[model samples]
Target chain A: MEQFIDVWIFGLGIATLTYAPPLIFAALGGLFSERSGIVNIALEGMMTAGAFFAIYVSVQTGSWVIGLVGAMLAGMALAALHAVATVTFQADQIVSGTAIILIAAGLVNFLNLTLFGAEGSPAELSTPPKPGGVSLLVPLALALVALTAFVVFKTPFGLRLRSVGEHPRAADTVGINVYRMRYIAVIISGALAGLGGAFISFNVSSYTENMVAGNGFIALAALIVGKWKPVPVLFACLLFGFSQGLASRLPFGSPELLNSIPYIITLVALAGFVGKSVAPAAVGKPYVKH
Target chain B: MTRRINAEAILVPFLAVIAAMAVGMVLTYLVTGWDPFAAYGSLIRGAVGSPSAIGATMLRSAPIILTGLSVMVAFRAGLFNIGGNGQAIMGLILAGVVGIKLGSLPGASHWIVALVGAAIAGGLWGALAGFLKVARGAHEVVVTIMLNYIAIRFGEYLLGLGGPLQEKGSSIPASKSFETSAQLPVFWRPDPFTEVHVGVLVALLAAGFAWFLIGRTALGYQIRAVGLQPDAAEYGGMSVTKITVIAMFIAGAFAGLGGAVATLGELERLQKSELAVIQIGFAGIAVSLLGRNTAFGCLFAGLLMGALDSGAVGIQNDNTLPSGVATKLIGVIQGVIVLFVGIDLVFRRLSNRIVGVFGERGGSGMVKS
Candidate 1:
């Protein structure tokens, strides 16, 4: 019984907590952009910018808090570009998103090489403190889930946002500013994704190239799996985190193959095992003001 | 009647390239403090200055052209295939298997068979995504992205320690070298350092094939019809499901051929590290978009991108900038180009005005739905 609690409950629980928050933050970010009638797959790009800026700021300012803010700003910058392209210019969201992804990657890696040189960020830097063997951001992430739920489902702004996403034409008739709401939602989405990226970097206490890997994509999967609801998205992220935790714990199996389990599960979720995921009616369509 | 040129089609892309290059110059100056002129001078010289540089550019262009065609085909069917990397991985693995295991085949048949096997492998991988989309309603973007990670992991396992494909009695995590007969025949040697193979010819053939398939064939018409309006196509007795799957297969096949050509053309064996860092798949996206999602357009765009890449190498060789800066700058330039191309409304108006000034009204470009 003790062994079972030690491994299955305690160990598994810690690992999940460590891994799931990033996905939660990013998935929630996806929720905002998507619910505001934009398909922002550039969540990955925004996260990349956040991840790089977090470490750089942490090193420079010697403050983890400032680092987190820097991360969000970086993400927001990228997201603003996405908004300009997709919302204002009425470009293909996917194409614009792809461009952002490439740009973020190149720009971040360029800055990393030029600033940090070959050795990378210093051996020591200010990272968030772990009060109970987990970072403070973990609880903050949980709080944001509740916060997001309240903001998205229980507010007038939430109603306006949903209206813009679902029926923008009608929403426009009702005096809701569709473009302003979308830009705000997408920018907020960037902030959240940036926080997610910061969490991943802070966990490691340093930055590495491609360190975020495909977690942004995984968070995207979580958004789909969670059906874009705040509570359900939290559960989906936890599920992915649990799988990652379990993969690390298994006594036997190729680590490479084991690492793929989360992705495969995401594929299965997207394949409709969790049920059909229907996007907002007006999502992915650019609204042209006549 | 005199044929009126569609000035927008030619002008917008040309202007976008100029805009992106300008952005690259500003970025280089702001970040590196390097003289943008000297950097660009070195870049151009590296791209087409010498026989060896041109050879290198051609070598790089071949795979990108094929992958570009891969993306182009899928775009015609109204599908976005972001899984070119995954498809290419599937192709390379099968190509590696055929190249390493099949030693008995005589002459060019061995390499030819390898390329065919690669196409089949890549096609099947792509078809899985299409099937999931049609049968299960899973978005291809998410599915294909997941597939890319899965393919990387799978390939890593195959080549990692104690795996089936790992070299026997060696510590290195890579497959055994291919037999001499399995390698592509090199037709040109610009210098002792550069051995140009027939992959360029293969890319050209594939581009021609794509042009014929999308422009001439009955299936091409169906693909275009479905892409334009799936509801109308379905009402007209076309199976959207079947077309999606077939188009994805063709897309995957071209990408797969790209992988095989790159591997057989360049490497002796498949290395484990290369699987994670393969940029050709994503590069295909830029190639397709910049090419305006056409076969010949892909050919020119791929060449341009390849030149930029080889030019980065030139920047490094000339010591014009710090190491690793040039490549990343080129990447930023490519991304900017894609952005400019995506938001081409600004360019369209400019092109129209220019055409008006010339007393020739510009025709509407192929506007993406």
Candidate 2:
């Protein structure tokens, strides 16, 4: 009994740590874009780009920090493309986001083929030294979550941002620069999401194709289940993480069944909790300055 | 007398494609230092230069057409069915299992049994999202995406060594080879060069059927009406709930058929682990977008994409550029084109102004549908 308890506790800890950074960063990122009236479903794609570019650059430069920086820039670049399509050009948010996701996947696979080849050659990178029992990025992610909560609930800028999302036309009447706010929000969101990607590459291990996996989408689900609030979002992320960890540590049954736990949890959450909630009035609609 | 050129619609998509291809060529050259002309030569030859290549392209296009229709069907009902991948995979697994079990039956009956199984599996999988959306008001986008992961994991589990579908006394992580009678028949010999089958014809026919349904039916009208304006549709006495459920079921069926074609017609076995993550479902979204959600448009888009995919191998073999580069190139092109299309209304407005200066002849540029 004691041994089982210990294993469970250990699994919980690891899962919490694993899910924290990416989930927190992605949720906060979603908050920024969605709060500013732009539905940023491209979070997954942006994170993937960040992960791939960070590792690619880090491998070449031998600096993890620089790799992190590269990831941010790459994410921002992709986000800017999305912004141009959805914000400036007034395209459909879902289509633009889908495009971004596909483009990111394509770019990563393309670069992988060019750099490593089809046989999945591992890219060599200088491992950034880290203290045992969880890396610095996890702490950074928690801090980010707290910071986001403060900004969205307590700050004037945050209020304006939320108003923009809730009613862009109303915000525009009140002299809020809807376009500018949304652009800034998306860019910031991209940067945070990119950081999440970098954490995976530098801290977890050398990057692999599809390394960000479906975490981006999972974070999006957390945002929805949490009702787009940072604090609640954190709890949602933790729950998902815990489930994932438990699934991974199970002693019996095939590991494949374990791999599906998070998805099943997400489905349940979506079905059970998310139905009663409502999204921002202007969530997916582009704010055209007519 | 003025001649209006729907030039922007034609030109924009055309230019976007050309631009993307040019960028792709440059990227390939930069990566591999291969001659651009030679690389393209190989691409063309691989896709259409020979009988086998043509067959291969057609085979690749089969699922894309169905998946594209799946997306189109959902979009027409104002839902984004990103779960096409999941639905298609479920269909494939169901077809595989049934195909194996019903091997004793006559070939025609066997095919019917497998196909029916696939349709049911895919339909139920899709209806899961629809049920959630209506019952809980959860966004289909998020739910569908989550379901995709579940489907993938489920597929992996079903194909595991200890799973029911696994071959007898075989250690591989895949199902047993399907009976010959269960396999989709080839239209012609693969010319000793490529693998293509009659599945391509099925895909083409499916596209036509989708077009006729969407453009010429009362059910399609309800879907379109709801898509255009849900509140107005409700005001007009249309049952939004029923439309949503039915539309999703139809969409799921199309995707399920796509998987059946690939499994029964192409692979002749259920290599779930290897075949599960092929991205045909997601790529179908690009096809739908490029085709502008029209049936004929999907056919052409699927063919173009299928050809490009088939050519990727040739590019790898013939050039120093990696095989995956073509795939990436297709992705970039797809994104750019969709982006352009997303802003198409604005572009149309601008072109209308330009044409006004020329004459009234250019005013008919807007697509009525």
Candidate 3:
């Protein structure tokens, strides 16, 4: 009985370490975009782009830090596409995000085909250096999460950003540049999402197709499960990580069934427990300069 | 003025599709470095020139058309049903199980049993989303997406070699070959040219039925009313919650039928395991959007997509382009179409003012968001 409990705890710890960096970073990215009144559903696509670029650049340059930076830039570039569609053209946020996802998928596949040809050669890339037997990225993620939580809740910039989200017109009337705030927020969101992607490539392995594998959506769930608060959101991500870790460790009758534990839990939580978590009133509403 | 606007709305989506195809042609040229004219010619030949190709195209269109309608129905009611893939998989598994268990039953009865089982499974899966939306105020988009993962995982578990539904003698992770008696029969004999089955008629019937339901039925009236304006709908004595649930149920049933058609019409048995890689359900979303969430639109859109897919196989054989490149091209075109459609309403206002060209637009007031 004691051994079982210890194993469970050990699994939870490993999960926290494995899952926290990416989840927190991506959720923080979501916070920036969403809090700024933009519905940023392209986090998944942006992360994927980042993951692809991180590995591509790292393999070319043999520098992990440069790869991470490249990943962030790639993420920003994808976000810029969303900005053009949703902000400039007044496109529907959902449709725009969906387009971005499809484009990202196509681009990745096309790049793979062009670079590796039909056989598709696997390229070796340098992993980010860790110190003191822990992934450096994990501590960096924790720090970023803490920093983001502080900025979102305590700072004046956070106040303005939240105001823009709650009522863009009102913020505009108050002389806040709503568009500028939203653009910056979304770009920042993209960069953070990219960082999460880089962690996967640099810390895990060379980018494989669909390596992000719904992690972006998982972060979105973590946002809802966290009640859109940064601290609670972090905890929620840890919970998901723990569930994932435990599931992986268990010698279940069917591994596939066991693997579905986190998703099923998330579905149940979204359906039955997350009661009417309201978004900012101005979400998905394009700020038209009347 | 309103009538003129409606006419223009109808033209925009069609123009959007043409524009997307044009862009896709350009991208295809860049990617494959092939002669554009030859590639397009091959596409046509593969899709429709040969009898077998045409038959295969029609057969492939069956599920997409139905699932596209499923998505269209839900979208009309202002819900994004991303769970089509999950629902379709569930339906497929349920139908397979029923078909195998009831193998002793007489001929057509087995087909009916399988079809009904699939429909029920899909309906239940879809209702889960509706239930969550109404009961917990959860967004259907998030819930549906999550449900998709669950469904895939569950399906993989059910279809695993040692799992329930696995073929008795099969060494692979797949269900048994459905009894020949249980299989959906081809309306026509295997001609030298094609593999068309009877499911195309069923898909057309489903399209016609969906069109009638949305256009003429009282239930559809409530659904549209709620979709257009929930507050006003409530004031008019319609239950928004009920409409949402019913709409999802119908949507799910359509997707379920799509899955059943795929299994009965094409595979005859569920093959392979690991659910994450299936593209049919997500492809349905693209079809629904490309069709502008309408019955007639879904039919044509489904046919176009099925043709592109079938043609892609031919393109792979004739050219150095990878098999997935063509499908990805279809996705790109679909994405471009949706992007254009979403911005079309805004663009039309600008174009109308700029060009002084006036015509009826079909969906001016219809696109709620």
> What is each predicted model's overall lDDT from 0 to 1?
0.89, 0.79, 0.78
Per-residue lDDT of A134-182 in model 2, one digit per residue for the tens? 7777777888888998888899889888998998899999898988888
Model 2 lDDT on a 0 to 1 scale: 0.79
- Superposed Cα deviation of residue B29, candidate 3 (Å): 4.7
**For model 3, what is the alpha-carbon lDDT of residue B265?**
76
| Candidate 2 residue pairs in clash (backbone atoms < 3 Å) | none
Tens digit per residue, CA lDDT, model 2, B156-222: 7778878767787988888878877777767676687555666687788889889988889999999
Residue B355 in model 2: lDDT = 59
Which numbered prediction scores highest in DockQ against the true structure?
1
Q: Where does the lowest 10-residue lDDT sum fall in candidate 1 chain A? A: A246-255
Question: In model 3, where do residues sit more than 4 Å from their true spots?
Answer: A1-12, A121-123, A130-134, A271-276, B1-5, B29-38, B167-171, B188-194, B271-274, B346-369
Task: Name the 10 consecutive residues with the lowest summed lDDT in model 1 chain B.
Answer: B360-369
Can you tell me the CAPRI class of model 2?
Answer: medium
For each candidate, report its DockQ versus the true two-chain complex. 0.71, 0.64, 0.52
How many residue pairs clash in model 2? 0
